[model samples]
Target: MPGTQLTVTLSGGDVADARAVVRALEGSFGAPDELPGDENATVRTATFSAAAEGASGRPAPAPSGGGQEGGRLSAPVTVTVQGTPEAVARAG
Candidate 1:
């Protein structure tokens, strides 16, 4: 079956909050398919990283020019959830 990717972005400073949210999601949805059991959904992968320059609306500055700081504190995470259509719909 097809899967869904849930991406959540938060301020880089809020790492704790981000982790908490991930834990909560895990508790609610159970683990992703790769984990082990069939009862819990599988999580293909969970990644956390700082937003790169120009990733957001703000663009990076030219070589000799000055611009707003491109490297702002931002956290971007991607979680992959896999399950049947009924399960997915219910989870949604």
Candidate 2:
């Protein structure tokens, strides 16, 4: 059976911060499969497979209780990482 996938989005902060954001995620997910058009875009996005821990050794903090619905955010410096329950949890 196929595994799962995760869509992680990080926005807000200076547009230049996009690089840093992607860098942070690299620890969890390998280099972004895709990236925003503008390198300095405030809103950056990345996608990762379930077994995408070939980037960094750091693991993202696990999420608290409650379900995490995949959706957009209306805030600055917002990070939305969504995927299968397991993938999401792992990415968290």
Candidate 3:
């Protein structure tokens, strides 16, 4: 079956830091099938497949209830998370 995919686009901050933020999400999702874009780009994107097999050959865990907590980034960043309606709800 096709998986639920999440495309995260990040702008502002350096590409490396933006990539770091996306990689951090792997703890809850999994390794992205499509990694962040060019290192020199001001904006980059990463895509994660929720139902796809990970390195362990198992689907990544479904994200569940969580509340946002105040935090600070090294620099200002604009982030956009896009996915199916169901997937976006699950991510929340």
Candidate 4:
């Protein structure tokens, strides 16, 4: 059976947000090919990783009102999607 793989890299402090986007894509498309039943559907797996110093650069400045300083953070997320050619096309 034919399948498709999709990877999306993200940099930020929030993981939920990244997940949300992936979920949205899956919902809009379908489940991954590896998953059962979702064979012809779109399935996604997200891998999160921190970015290097030179990549993200310094963290954002501290907020006003004497709040704790915010550190620079980066997250790289890879979303692998698989599905049939028809499914992949539909998802695309």
Candidate 5:
């Protein structure tokens, strides 16, 4: 099936946090094709491949249980979503 590709930017974010975000969004989009690395760069990126919608018009699976605790700074973060209109809408 033709799917959608999504690119998300995690600016001034940590890998664990980014992973958490990915986990949280797994329901909308399947596991990311590219997950953030362990590097704590000022900016990072993650690529995800999604099916737009799940079976029987239902949403995808929820994220797994696991995360870290820590405060973060409100830095500039950007998100780039690209895919079919329907897929994009579903991801959004």
Candidate 6:
């Protein structure tokens, strides 16, 4: 079966803020095809790929905010997550 793809977009904050969220998700989704850029764009996006749920050995565990922190967000952000139903559920 084809793998699932998740695309997350963060707005209303700088790249650092976006990176934080992305990094947090990386714990579950693995690496992203697109990483947030340093440029001062209004939006930042990251795309991650994963095998369909139950199609692989096991899913990655969700990330925790307490241990080994990912990063801090300087401000609030508007996140837009897009993908197939399975992909969205996995990312959620």
lDDT values, one for every candidate: 0.34, 0.56, 0.66, 0.35, 0.61, 0.72
Tens digits of per-residue lDDT for model 5, 14-57: 66666666665667776677678867476667666544446555
Greater-TM-score candidate between 3 and 5: 3
Model 4 C-alpha lDDT per residue in residues 1-92, reported as the tens digit of each score: 22233444433425544445444444433322222222232333442112211233322222233211242224444444444454345335
Rank list by lDDT: 6, 3, 5, 2, 4, 1
TM-scores, in order shown? 0.28, 0.54, 0.65, 0.32, 0.63, 0.73
Model 4 C-alpha lDDT versus the unseen true structure: 0.35
Better of 1 and 6 by TM-score: 6
RMSD list, candidates in order:
16.4, 9.3, 6.1, 16.2, 3.7, 3.9
Candidate 5 lowest-lDDT run of ten:
67-76
Highest-scoring model, TM-score: 6
Please identify which of the two predictions, 1 or 6, would achieve the higher lDDT against the true structure: 6
| Model 1 agreement with the true structure over 4-89: per-residue lDDT tens digits | 33333323234433344444444334332222222233222332122212345232232331212443324443434444454335
Cα shift from native, residue 42, model 6 (Å): 0.2
Q: After superposition, how far is residue 65 of candidate 5 from its true place, in Å?
A: 0.1
Error of 4 at 53 (Å): 37
Candidate 1: regions farther than 4 A off: 29-92
TM-score leaderboard ranking? 6, 3, 5, 2, 4, 1
**Model 6 C-alpha lDDT per residue in residues 29-58, reported as the tens digit of each score:** 765776798677898888877652235635
| TM-score for candidate 3 | 0.65
Q: Quick one: best lDDT, which candidate? A: 6
3 versus 6: better TM-score goes to? 6
**What local lDDT score does residue 60 receive in model 5, on the 0 to 100 scale?**
61
Clash number for candidate 2: 4
Q: In model 5, what are the clashing residue pairs, if there are any?
A: none
